[model samples]
Target chain A: MEKIKSIIEVKNLNKSFGSNHVLRDFSMEVVPGESLVILGKSGSGKSVLIKCIINLIVPDSGEIYVLGQNIRELDQDQMDKLRAEVGFLFQSNALYDSMTVRQNLEFPLRRHWTKEMRDLNAQSAVKEALEDVGLGHTIDMMPAELSGGMRKRIALARTLILKPKVILYDEPTTGLDPITAREISELMLQVQEKYKASSIIISHDMNCIRMTSDRVIMLIDGRNYISDTYENLQNVPDPKVREFFD
Target chain B: MIHLIKIDSEFLREVGEIARFTGRFFSEVIKPKQEWEEFINQCFWIGFKTLTLVGITAFIMGLVMTIQSRPTLLEFGAVSMLPAMVSVSLVREIAPVITALICAGKIGSGIGAELGSMRVTEQIDAMEVSGTNPFKYLVVSRVLASTLMVPLLSSLAIAISLYGGYLGVNIRGNVSWHLYWLQSFGALGYGDFIPSLIKTFFFGFAIGIVGCYKGYNSKKGTEGVGRSATSAVIVASLVVFIIDLIAVQVTDLLGLT
Candidate 1:
């Protein structure tokens, strides 16, 4: 296997809420154009880790280098610029309930471009994003009208609209049916291949771990146990690793 | 004693929450993107939807005030003072306060419930994770809508109230419609109109910010959404009266009357 350039590097990341230590000196890295899956139980700082990398929540003491830039140290405007290059899919698809699917896709695009700059040209981009996610026919439907799987697909369309360099998935398959989950995992691969972007997925689903990851990182008790290939992870003899799979 | 202490602590916590929520309004107001579309939507919801209710109430209010005051004026042989008194009371004190109270019941609860459900269902978290600024989109837009729209609604309500007052005068006797308006405006100077109008903006701001705050910070489930909606309406109503009282005292101290 060829080693690619590191697009993200984290060192000594620490975060806490009041007395609960969420992420304690956590650290890891993702190579450019590689797919990495983070495996952890709920409340183990998986979501916080993703948020900190994007500077949504500032870490207490740490360094997060995304695309070779220290994301933690950047100012708000600078951070916003950096954030535009990264896409995030939330556990619960956060489509605006009040808006139609088309409006949801257009929201991020219109926000990124001013009204005068956003004309007929951007409309095609929104349509293309909708088509990419297999949601072209559901453009006028509200999120409440869609099933869970369909909503997730629309959210993916919105995320891809920005053409992000890195895609972060937070529990992408948590509540989906097995078939839907499989399709989502497959779509993740498709997105990776199409965009040629680095991808990070946080999940407890072993099926998702096995299917979507090129490298697996186990997070147990606020620490990284191992970062290796899926086959290597399954063959390991660590009690914690065994327990996770069991 | 312990129970009393617990109650006090709970009250303080609620008060602190409301104050913190209101404080955030100032902070978010200075931020960018304005969320103009969302603001217009909120105006449509808060001002346009509630217009009929506010109008009816104001109209009845004017009718009742005029009718009640006419008899009292007649008893004192000062029947001409009816228009002046009703207009002064409505424009200066009654209209803004009543309109705000009604809005606190309607718009405040709506905002609180909407945002609270959104919070509980993880919609807000989704916005943040998606690299969208929820504060700018949700808080600023709603606040701007309330601040701008409430005044317009209040003006419409006052106008309706005056029409109702005209009807009240015509019921028992004849008063020229033109003279009735003249007398109404005769009593209202810029002193009454400007201060009263100025304070409605704050009233609107308070209602909007408090509703958004309560809903935005709602707890993890369905019950929390209800609590947020209830608290928002209660706190917003209290804020309206508090602002009205302060406005009255300040205006009196300034000798504007």
Candidate 2:
């Protein structure tokens, strides 16, 4: 048995929107190269937790450490720099509608890579990322022209172009058909293995969670209610844990 | 009374937010990370693409003002006063404000809807998460474009309007193009040109600022996009009038009017 390094640690996070308390004393840790799924129904604060980890939404009270630096202590510049290492796939795909797929893929490189570097390697990087998602030919098409499955793949390709150490997927399979969902699930597995990337997937899709997540955390009532392997968690007789399996 | 208070509070909150948003724009715009490419593209869109609309509106306005004012001046046997009256009114007030109003409808709504759709669709978020400055790329470019274009548009508008008044003068009367030009130019003073031009920059700023704020702070889902676009035009239109009033007052105090 080998020891695994902790890539992300979230402890005692509390968030509220006026009267609506979203996350309460929620805590979790994600080890390096692991797939951890946060499963919650609508409005259960699963998305909020992922946002907090990425420094998008600040929690009312919490300690979040990413790659050993306390997120709260990082300045805006530091947070922005850290963002390049942590890829986030928004549920809506968020492909730049005004830009073509190649341009969208080039966006991060333009920001993070120097002009010379981008000029020299951007084309190759875009091609490789597109190839990773199996959509190499759709590079020049607009986001509007792409099918949902294709758009999602483009977004994944965009995220992968940066070769982010940790990928945060927010409802990656939410709006897809069952077949598409299964394909996306398989892609997530492939991404994990290929990139050797630690990932925090925020999802409610049973098939997605079952296939992609190595460990699942049930988020209910604004808390991390249960955390275990998929098969082991199914055996738990507790009603709260059983609710997910049943 | 309670409703009134609520409205007042909401207004104050929005004002505060706009101020903060403006501050953020300034900070990002000055930083080494600049979006000159996007800014130039926006300048072309906001300035060049808007030329036809502004020209048509300005032409109609100059002609209509000449026609409408002719009756009153004619009663006093002051038919020759037509060009001077229309010219002064158009250059000093009408052209700038009318063009601004048109921009409030056209540019303001366009920017609002574009950014609103981006916000709702999470393109803005994607930019941020990818470590790109959305404000710098989106807001600074558009605002700078509007601020620069308004004055140029107003100047173009004034020229076209004078031409329009010239055509109106010839419709029922014989005034040479030379005399019409002399009268129109003679009527415009340093006072009229400077004050009117300055105020338009503010109008441009107002339109750009209000539109961006509405769209950037839009709520979630499809309906939020509509709300963002509508509120952008409404608030921008209102702010144009308010800015015009303030500009007039300031010029009056300085004896520029």
Q: Top model by lDDT, which number?
A: 2
CAPRI band for model 1: acceptable
Q: What TM-score is obtained by chain A of candidate 2?
A: 0.97
Candidate of highest DockQ: 2
lDDT of 1 by residue, A1-246 (tens): 544367888898898899988887888999889899999888999988997887767889989998878986677667767777888888877778888988888777655676766685577878888888787889899998999999999988888988999998989999999999999888888889998989889999998889989999888888887889989888899888888877
* Tens-digit lDDT string for candidate 2 (A1-246): 445368899999999999999999999999998899998789999988998998878899989999777999998789888898999999999999989999999999877899999999999999999999999999899999999999999999999999999999999999999999999999989989999999999998889999998899999999999899988898999988787778
User: What's model 2's lDDT at A155?
Assistant: 95
TM-score of each: 0.91, 0.97
Residue B107, candidate 2: alpha-carbon lDDT: 91
RMSD each, Å: 2.9, 1.9
- Expressed as tens digits, the lDDT of each residue in B139-241 for candidate 1 is 8888889888788888888899988988988887688999999999998899998888899999999899888988998996999999999999999999898
- How many angstroms is residue B73 displaced in model 1 relative to the true structure, after the best TM-score fit? 4.6
In angstroms, the error of model 2 at B124 is 1.4
